[model samples]
Structures are given as structure tokens and as C-alpha cells.
Target chain A: MNDSLRVVLAMIELELRRLRNDRTEVFTRAVQPVLWLVVFGTVFSQLHAIPTSGIPYVDYITPGVMLQSVLFVAVLYGLTLVWERDTGILKKLLVAPAPRYATVIGRSMSSGVRAIIQVVIIIPVALLLGVSFIPNPAYFVAALAILFVISGGFAALSIIVASLLKTRERFMGIGQALILPLFFASNALYPIASMPRAIQIVAVFNPLTYAVDAVRGLMITGNLALLPLDVAVIALFDILMFAVASLSFRKIIE
Target chain B: MTFAIDARGLEKVYKGNVAALAGVDLDVKAGDIFALLGPNGAGKTTLMRILTTQFKPTSGEAHIFDLDVVRDGAEVRKVIGYVPQETSVWSDINGYENLLIYAKIYGLPSRSRKDVIHDMLESMGLRAPAEHLVKTYSGGMVRKLEIACAMLIRPKILFLDEPTLGLDPAARIAVWEKLVSFKEEFGTTVFFSTHYMDEANAYSDEVAIINTGRMVTSGTADELKHSLRGELIKFSLSDHRVDEHTLGRIRGLEPVKSVVVTDSTLNVTVEDAETALPCVMDALRSEGIPVERITTTKPTLEDVFLWYAGTTRAPGAASSIGRVEGKAGGTRRE
Candidate 1:
């Protein structure tokens, strides 16, 4: 294999070892999303806290919870950058002849793989709760594709932050600051139109909003409502974020 | 080129006007084990970082094996293995996996990768513990593993930044042995940075002292020690308890550059020990002070460090052996 491919795979393989060493990460990550679906979704379902268009609360929140998990999983990958840099792995890799961007892609790919696992866990649980998958096979594929793209984008973003900050505590502080505000401000928790006027303005720009809307519309409403624009915006954001991430990571290594 | 590493007028200033390197000019011959010595915050690490292609100097140039460190970093990196001061290993991974990862990066033949890893581990005395996670290894073992990883490139030159800073005496000795063996076998250029005076004196074929980001002097350990044109005389008083009167008596002797007393022994720096030793002994004898043991030896790297760092022992004042007096030992600019 080419050096870049080897480097990226090597990084992912290390993460796989860690994941195998501790299955707790997968279990722990599923906790918050599961709670949101079972406890919050069910409790709110009885009260009809927000409109779900007669669809079950679990179904409406399914896309939101998955995207939330992606955000947590993706950005958390970057926070670990602090530990790696502090311990000297980052420098060890930086001195290699392989391209610096390969490391960035490698890290993002690892996060994407972990998020894929999250999606696998959430799907069965969501279905058990009476949440329906997308009717058409093609749309289901589109939802999966959206999940990968958004996950990669957010993961790239975390690496960018980690590169800039160069401290685990600080990266986490920043990542934590981002995940919830982005989740609550977007259409993940409620429809964009239903939110306050100012929130509607912010959610329109939130990548999570596009991601959840695209996934929810595809799998729930079956209309792919705004799916193209949503995909385009998230795709554009991913490209921009990846570019910045590569540049920023390069600066750190250089 | 004769020089494996060279720098001229190299300057590095951090973002907030912090000048880590202030116009450093240095050179190291190929196949030489050159050690850079400095006290903390003397910019040894910064200079190594620049030479290793980890950072850019604000001005001037550095070349590693004929390639400019900045402009031709990709080429420089290929030929130079840099084991930075950080614990340059993944604690979560075992030693063998760490080597294989770098072996891939170094483009080692797939067939030989495992064998190469095994050989390096064995050479570093880590073969028994090679499969254990790095987190479980001792500080020295981890450092040895780091060396093994860096060696995957079979670099023309290896740059180590404080390779044995925290290692115990035995571990440090083990690391030194492997380094020497590697040099002998491969004839690779080894340029390392260290604050440990003893290690530099004991291990390096050549040593350079850096102060405030500038080269103070460069030479063999004996050469640096002899540069000051003096001998270090150490003597323990037979019966006289060390009081200010006794210390002052020794300090009052003319031609003595500095006098340091620890316990009952006195270390004096004088222009020429042969001429000065008898005079000192007679003078003390005349003063009714009995000397038990007196030995005049060549200056140590510690003395050279003190002289270059401007940390001469003050009259009648006993300073710690290694801690240079800050007020006097402030890094000499010129």
C-alpha cells in the first residue's frame, strides 16, 4: 500500500486495538443517546412536549440522537490529540515521511469508524422502540452516507481544534462547549420553524441541523425534504473543515 | 560534506518576542557522537528542535546532511532520526507494534519488518519485554523503545534530545551502551542534547556547551576543561574545622580564581596546579592547618560549565555542587 494509505490504516488499527482492549468506550458512548431515546423520548412522548406529526417521539428524535452521538464521538477524537501530543506520539508520527494530512484523515477516519459502530447500536434500539427505517433502500443508503460525511466533518473539526489548542483539557473544554450548544440550537431537538426566531437563524447555519434534517427526512417522512441542500451544505462544510484541519495540523507538525 | 549537522546565525523567536534561539552557529562532524550541553532554559531543546525540522528558525540557516532543514525538510527528515525529549512512544501499544508502525513509515521491506523489530528490541535490551504494553515499562525501557522506533529509518544521523533525562544510572548506562554500539556498527552520526554534565563528558566524542541560545565552546571533554588554563585542586583538611576564617584564608591566596568548600574538602581553581599546589600547601602549613589528602586533577566538565556560565564560587560561600548560583551563573552572552 501507499505510504498515506498505510499511515491512515495504521492509525485506525491502533484505535481498533484500544477499542478491543476496552469495550467500555462503545458502551459508555451509547449511554447518553440511549437515555435520550428511552427516558427523555418516552417521558416527552406522553406529554407531547413538541410536535412529531403523529410519529412516535423515538422516531422523531432518532436522527437527532444519532447525529448527537456523531458530534460527541467525532470531536472527542480530537480531544485525545492532546494526550497523544503530550505523550510524544504526535511528534513521532510528525517526523515520518508520510504526508501530514494523512494523519488528519487517519484520525477522522478512526472517529468515523467509531461513529459507525454507534449507528449500528442505535439502529436496533431505535427499531425496537418502534422507530421506522427509511422505506426505500436508496434513501437508507443516503442516510448512511450522510452519517459518514457529517461524522467525518465534525471529526475533522475536532482535530483542527486539538491542533490549535494543543491541550487535552482545553480541547475538551472547547469540544464540550460546542456539542450541546450546537445540538440544542439546531433542528435536532425540535423543528427549525418551531424554535425561537433567533434559534431558527442559528439552526439554519448549524451543520448538525442539516445532518439531522437530512437523515430524519429521508428515514421518517420519506420525502428527502431539503436532503440535497442539506447534503450539499454539510458536504461543503466538510470540505472547508477538512482543508482547515489539514492546514492547521500541518502547522503543528511543522 | 564533512559536517553532518551545521547551523549558522540561526535565530528563533516565539510569537510573543520570546527568543528561544539567538543566532546560534554550530557544526557537527559526520560519524561523531556530539553532545550539546546546557542548563535548563538555555535553548538546547529549541536548537535541536530546529535542526530536527520540527520548527523553523526566525532567521538564518541549518542544514542536516547537506539539505537545508527548512526548505528541504522532507529530504532532511528522511535521513535524520529525531527522538525528541518527550516520551516518544505510544503507551497504549506494545513495543513491537510501535516498531512495525514506524517500519511501515520508513518503507522497510515487509518481509524484514518483524526481524528488524526483533533485532532492535534485542539490541536495546528490551527483547524480553518487547510484547508488553509500553505503559507498563520503566522510564528507561520506554526510552530504549523510543530509540528502537527512531532507528527504523536507519538514519544517517540520529538526533536525541535529552535521551536519558529521567533514567536511573543503570538505565542511562544501558542507553549509552546501545548508542555506542549503534555508532560502531552503522557509523551513524549521533548528535544529542543533554543537560547532564556527566553523560556528556562520559559518552560524547565531542561536546558543545550552549548558553542563552549561543555556542559557548565546543571540544572534547578534556579540551573544554583545559580551555581555562587551570587545574582543579581538591583537598580535605586534616583537623581544621571549616569556619569562615579557614575558608577566607584559602580565598585570600593570590592567583586563585575561585574556592569552593564542601564539608571539609576544598576545590580551588588556580592558574597552574603544579606551581600553585605547593604554594597553597605551604601557606596552609604555615598557618598551622594540616592537610590530610591533597590531589590536583584536570578540570572537570562541571568546572568548564561553571567558568563558561560565569558561576565561579564566591569566596567563603559554599554553593550546592550542581546548582549554579543564579546571581553569578547567569548565562554568559559572549
Candidate 2:
């Protein structure tokens, strides 16, 4: 109906069309998280390396792997922006009559769809490894919502990075540098209680920490107590990122 | 009457103080095809970007159909369609899908969107390949598709940057034919930039030559060529007796404006080739020099460009005159 809403929907349609044409990325991207669940989950579960409150190691890390998959897909979304800018696609977009911020919002939202594809792929692999998710459908729906919100925030951050670093080479170096630190510093692979005091502080600031906490609490722990705090932090991250990303979006064309 | 586009003292200074457009002033009439001709890095693209509202000029003002491009960018964008120099169509998507996205972006009515895209594809002769991916199409087809996308909205003005670059001659002709028909059909002002002299000379109603970000001159192609105000007489000497004394005697003749010698060949610009050719011949023959071949021809756009822009040809410029080594004993009209 409205221009911004229309742009977002059009972008989603573009992603769907692209996916329909080639589905290899959705399947190939599933491989890394599957490996984490099968190889790393099995090795750690036998040794009982970290306490999981009696939860199976494979099940405990299933949500983390899903968030990891989503994070990787969303954060790398800016690469598309850089490539588009170099190829002159961005010039056409910027010259259109639509609001400038809508382009950023629309493109970032498409990354959420890409994240959803990764989630669907990981769910099957998790089940294959005998990982159990809470049998509640509402909580399952809530987990997907949380994942989408997390993805929108990370995708916006990726666009901001793209606006700053215009070259693909520079963006790739910085994107890889940002992704691993965000994953390792967060509680995705381990509990923050086992991390050093400095890393604990860093993990508190990392949005991925709150994302994993929400998904892990929703589908695995079924403990909805900290759910409100996790959701608030993630929503706040999303809003802040979208604002900054919208402000800097035009710089990619410059 | 309001011009279709007007720019005054537009200046864009990039980072490190690199001036892409120093100070350009331009105006285009409505429903006319205007060509901005220049060599590479001559600020043609920069000026187009500013006019299209993709980049803000560091200083000065531009208006599209009297709407300020910077202050009212949305309004300007509504009336202008831009085809950038690079290939903007998605290689991964079909031609139809590419048009669909652009149609949505331009806010075309949802109900008519399909019909509009189909008609444009057909008009551009891309209807047969509408379902095929753009990557499979030839370079000319890809260009036509981009033009179709820009024209989908039927904007009042269409801006293209190097629209036919890297296309073969037949493809270039195809692209121009579509543009000409589009202009005639919609009365849309077609503003495009190109370094090719022939395209400018042949297609444009008005042509502006830019050199290093400044507007060198602007007029119809005929006006530019006729501004040289003389005929060129080209002749070569078979005998080696012709020397500076002979060239000076020829320059001293009443009708000769300038004389330039390159190796065995001599180029003489004269008030009238009819009167000057025999005098040149007699001067050479008096020095016991035998003329190999002599011909008189009107000055072409390339000759005009060289006289005004510089003696050297711009890189990648198609030449009507073979490479100019140097001018000698010559007076080039200032």
C-alpha cells in the first residue's frame, strides 16, 4: 500500500524469484551448521565438557547453530550491496522516486528470508541428530520471530559496513573479521559463565548473545522467564541498526 | 519557455579535492535529443549523475523541468528516468523479472504493471527473450532491456550515460533507433552522454562538447563544423625539394589561412580551396617539387574538435583525420 511497505515486499519477491531459480545456496549453507551439530556436538556431548543443566549437548547447541547460520547469512548480506554499487545497480535504485531509506530497509529484510531458509535446513539436521525441541508450536513460532528480528538487525549492520567500506575486498576482510569475533565473544558456543571476565563483559554487549539466549530459552530450555529481557535487547538492537543504516545508505552511491 | 533541464555553475569536488565537475552550465530544450560529447573523464557522467539526482553537486544548482534537483529530488526523480553507464539489469533474473522490479520501484499501478512491461519488451524487440535470463542476451539486448526499464515509467526526461559503449555497430544502431522512436512517441527529452563523434553528429538535435569539466562549446553539429570557416586542402610532395622556404611562400599567399606539414604530406587551410590550390601548386612547382596527390574537403567534426579542444585526438576517439603529428608554420584561428 505505502511506498516503504511496497519496497520491502518487492525486495522479498526478488529474493524469492532468485531462490526459485537457484536453490543451491540454501542447501550448501546448511552444511556448516550440520557439521557443528554432528561432529562438534557428538564430541562434546561424550566428554561432558560443559554443564548444560542436564540437557543433551546436541540439543543444547541446536539453537546456537541455528542462530549461527542466521548470523552468517544476514551479516554477509552487505556484500550484495557492495557488488551492486560497483555494477551500477545502486545508481538506478537511488535515482528512483522511492524514499532512500526504503532501499536499505527492503534489502535488509530480504536477508531475513535468507535466514529463514537456513533455519528450515537446520531444523531437519537437528532432528536427524536426535536433538529435541520443545513440542510447543507457539514457542516454535516465537523462535522464528526472534531469529528474524536478529537477522534484520545484523543485516542492517552489514549494510552500514557496506556504506563505509565501498570495495568488495575491504568489505570481505572486515566482514569476516566482525563475524567470528561476534560469534566467539557471545554465548553461542558456550555459556557465558565459563568465559573469562573480560569476555563476559564483551558478551553482554554482543547482540548475538541475546539472540542465542532468546532462541535457546524458547525451543530448548522452555524457560520463558528471561525471554522478555532478551526480546527487548534484540528489538532495541534492530531499531538502532535500522536507524543508523538508513542514515548512511546513500553513501554507498556516493 | 522553461527548459527541460537547466544547470548553472554546477561543481562537484570529490574527496582529496578531485574536481569531477569544475563549473558546468547547461540547458536542454524540451522534447529534443541532447548529446553531451566529451573524452573520457571529461565530467559527462558526473554532470549526468548530478542532474539525475544520484549525486549532489558540491556547489551550484540544477533543475529538471524547473524542479530543483537537490531541494526537490523526489519530484525531479518522478519526471526523469536514468540508464547508468554500467549494466544495471540483474543477470540472474529473466528480462521480465527485471522489468517487474523496476516497475514496482517506479510505483507503476499494480494492475497495469504486467501490460506495461510486456508492451515495453515487445517495443524493444525483446519480447521473444522476455522469459530468458539477461545474462544470456547479447550486449545490445541487455542495453535495450535497460532502456526499456528506464522508459517503463514514461518520464518526461530520460538520461543515459554512454548508452552504446562497447556495443557493436549494428547494436549501436539498434539502440539509437529505439531511442529515436521513444523520443518521437513520448516527446520525452533524451539526454545522453557519449565520446563517439559520429553518434553525436548523427543523432543529436543539439550537441555540447565538454573538455575537462568545462563546457567548451554547444550548438547543432552543422554549426560546430561550419565554425571552422575554411576548407582543408590535403596534398603530398613526391620530390624532396620542398622546404621551409617553400612552405613560407605558400603561407604568404593571399588565400592561405594556415599550412601544416607532416612528413611528405601537407595540410593547408585556406579561405577558398579554389583560389588557394593553384597558388599552392604553383608555389611547389616553382621550387621544382612534384605534387603526388591533392584534394579539397570540408572540415569535419573531428577537425573542429581538434582545433578547439587540442591538436591531439582523445584516446579511443574514432578518427576522420589520421594522427596529427604536429602543426607547423600555421595560424590556427583562436
Candidate 3:
């Protein structure tokens, strides 16, 4: 295989190995979304006055829960960067002949794959909780693509933050603080129309809103019409974020 | 012979305040073991970091095998293997897995990786612990694994920073032996830094001494020792006070170059101790001053460091031996 492909494959294998060994990470990532889907969905379902569509609360929250999991688990990309810096592995990689871009790409790909695994694990549990997957195979594929793109974008953003920050604790603090605010401001929990006028405008610009809308459309409405635009926007954001991250990382290494 | 690595007027200032390195120059020849000796914070690690392309120089240039570290970092990295002072391995992984991962990062061909991993592990004396998690290994074992990882690439230039810092005596010796064997077998240019003067003198073909972010001197161990003009002799005096006339008399001796009096001892720097010692004793005896003990010792790298760096004896400062000397070995320079 060519060098770039080999690096990507190696990184993927490494991540998978760690995931297998650290069952806690797998369980933690898998459990958070499942709880949100079951407990929150049921509790919120009783409050029909809260204004989700005639669609059951489990169905409404399933997409949001999956997207949140992707966001949360993808933060590991930044944490792993911190870990590598502390351990000196980042220096070792910095001195390698492999292209610098490949380092960022390989890491983002690993995070994206992990996010997909969590999404897959949540799917069955979502079904048992009375949430239905769209019958169309194309819609399922589109949903998967959206998940990868969104996760890749988030992971890239995490890398940029981690590279610019000096310490792991600082990065985690900034990352966690940013995540909750972004999630609350977006249309993840409710439709944009139900939100206030100012928040509706912000939700329109929120990348997560598009991701949640795109995935929810595929998994519930079986609509793939917006799939192209949604995927394109996410891809563009991923590229831009990754470029920024790579530049910052290059500065750090240099 | 072409220099494997050449650095000229290298300067690195972190945060625009801390001067980690200041206009240092180095020429490491191909296929030689060069040791950079210094105390902590002497900029040894910073220089290595810059050479390995982990950090950029604030000014000046470094070239590895004719390739610029900045403009040609990719090419430079292809030929350099750096084992940093810290243990960079993933503690969560097994030794075998760590080596394999590093091999992949070096872009080793898939067919060669398995054999390379096995060979590196065996060479580093980590074959028995290949299956064990790195966190379970001792400090010495972790260091061995790092060396194995760095060697997987079979680099042309190997930079080891404090390679034996925390290792026991036997482990340190084993590491030195492996380094020697590797250098002899592959002709790799090895540049390592150490605080151990004896180890540096014994293992390195040449040593560079750095102090306070500047290069003090660099040369073979024998050349450095021979460059000193006199033997250092000390005499314990019963009284701190010695008459100026008596001190002048000692200075007028045939081979005594200078006499320095401290609180409880008399220090004499002399060219020929055999000729100077009798003259010194005769003067002290005639003056009726009691000499408790007299000792003469060869000039060590530590003495050379003190003469050039103007530093006093301090804890952890003793290891700053092998201080680099400019031509003429002068005490002060602009």
C-alpha cells in the first residue's frame, strides 16, 4: 500500500485495539446515548405539551442522542493529542517521514469510525425503545455518511483546540464548556421553529443542526433530497477545520 | 569526512523570553559517537529538539546530511531517529504492539515490519517482555523499548537524550554496550547527551560541553585534559591567615603558576608539581605554619568547566563537567 493509506490503516488498527482493551471507553460511549434515548425520551414523551411532532418522543430524541454521542466521543481526538504530547509520542511522529497531513487525517478517521460504532450500537437499543429505522436502504446509507462527516468535522475542531492549548486539562475544560452551549443553542432538542427568534437564527448556522436534521430526515422521513447539501456542508466544514488543525499542529511541532 | 549533522549559530528562544539556546554551533562527523554533556537547563535538550525538527530554531540554521532542518524537514526526518529523554511509548500497549506501530509510522514495508519488529525487540533485550503491557515494565525496560522503537527505522543519525538517566548500573552498562555495538555494526552517527562525566569520557569519541545556553567547548577527552596547563594541588592549613610575604614567596617558586588562599586551605596551580611541591613545603616550614595534609590531583573536566564557566560548586553542578573550551582555553571572553 502507499504511505498515506498505510498510515491511515495503522491508525485505525491502533484505535480499534485500544477500544477493545479499554471496555470502559466503549461502554461509556455506548451507555450515554442509550440512557438519553430511553430515560429522557420516555420522560419527555409524557410531556406532549413540550411540542415535538406527532412522532413519538423516542423517535424525536433518537437522532439527537446519536449526534450528541458522536460529538462527545469525537472529543477524544483532542484528548488523544494531549496524551500524545505528554507521552512524547507526538514528537516521535513529528520526526517521521509520513506527510504531516496524514497524521491529522488518520486521527480524524479513527474518531469517525469510533463514532459510527457507537451509532450502530445505539441503533438496536433505539429500536427496542419503540424508535423505528427508515425501511429504505439508501436512507440508511445516507444517515451513515452524515454521521461520518459530522464526526470528522467535530474531531478536526477538537484537534485544532488541542493543538493550540498547552495542557490537557485546559483543553478538556474549554471543550466541555463549548459542547453544552453549542448543543443547547442548536435545534437538537427541539425544532428550530419552536425556538425563540434569535435562537432560530443561530440554529440555522449551527453545523450540528444541519447534521441532526439530515440524519433525522433519513432515519425517519426517508428523505434523501437534502442529503447532498447536508453532506457537502459537513465535508466543507471538516476540510476547513482540519486545515486549521493541521496548521496549528505544525506550529506546535516546529 | 562530511558531517552527518551540521549546526551553525543555532538560536532558540522560547516565548521570546527564555533563551533555551543562544547562537550555538556544532559539527557532528559521520560514524562517530559525540556526547553533549551539560547540567539540566543548559539547552542540551533544546538543541536536540531543534535538530530532530521537533522545534524550530529562532535564528540560524541546522542541516542533516546537507538537508536543511526547516526547508527539508521531511528528508531530514527520513534519516534521523530521535529517542527523547522522556518515555514516549504508549503505556497501555504491549512492547510488540508499540514497536509495530512505530514501524508502520516509519513507513516500513508490510513484509518487513514483522521481522523488523522482532529483531528490534530482541536487539533491545525486550524479547522476553514483548507480550507484556508497557505500564507493567520497569523504568529500565521502558527505556529499552523506546530505544528499540527508535532503531526500527535503522536511521543514519541517532540522537539519544539522557539515554541512561534512571537506569541502574548494570542496565546502563548494557545500554552503552548495545549503543557501541550498533554504532560499530551499522556505522550510525550517534549523538547522546549525559550528565555522567565518566560515562561521557568512556563512551564518546568526542564530547561537547554546554553551559547556560552556550557551547563552552568540544573535543576528545584526552585532548581536553591535556590542554590544561597545570595540576591542581590543595593543602590544609592550621590557620586561615598566611602572611602576604609567605604567599609571595610561594608564588615565586619555580613551577608554581599561582597561589589562591581560601578560608581553611591553600590552593596552588602549578605546571610541574614535582618541582613546585618541595619549594611550597620549604616555605611553609620556614614560616612555622603547620600543614595538616597535602594533596595533588590531575585536572578533571569539572575543573576545566569551573575555570571557563566561572561557576562555583553547587548541588547537581558537579555533573557539568567536560565544559567546552575555545582555543587557548582562556578564562574569559567577550
Q: Give interface RMSD, per candidate.
A: 2.0, 0.9, 1.6
Supply DockQ values for each candidate. 0.45, 0.70, 0.62
Say which candidate scores most in lDDT.
2
Cα lDDT of model 3 by residue, B86-204, tens digit: 77888877899988888887888889889989888888888999998888998888888888888888999899999999889988988888889889999988999987777887888
Q: Which stretches of candidate 2 lie over 4 Å from their true place?
A: B235-294, B310-334
Give lDDT tens digits, candidate 3, residues A76-151: 6655687677567888777777877778777877787789889999999998988878888987887888887788
Consecutive 10-residue window with the lowest summed lDDT within model 1 chain B? B314-323
Model 1 per-residue lDDT tens digits across residues B29-80: 9999999888788898888878877778999999888899999988888888
**lDDT values, one for every candidate:** 0.80, 0.85, 0.80
Write one digit per residue (lDDT tens) for candidate 2, span B2-84: 69999999999988999988899999999999998887888888899999998799999999999999999989989998999
Which structure among the candidates has the greatest TM-score?
2
lDDT of 1 by residue, A1-254 (tens): 38778877777777776666567789889998988898888888888888877777778999999999988998887667767766667776777777777877777877877887788798888888888886788888788788877887898888787777875556657988879898999877777878889988898888999899898988887766587899789989987887899888855554
Q: Candidate 2 chain B — worst ten consecutive residues by lDDT sum?
A: B325-334
TM-score of each: 0.84, 0.89, 0.87
In candidate 1, the residue pairs with backbone N, CA or C atoms under 3 Å apart (3 or more residues apart, or in different chains) clash, namely none
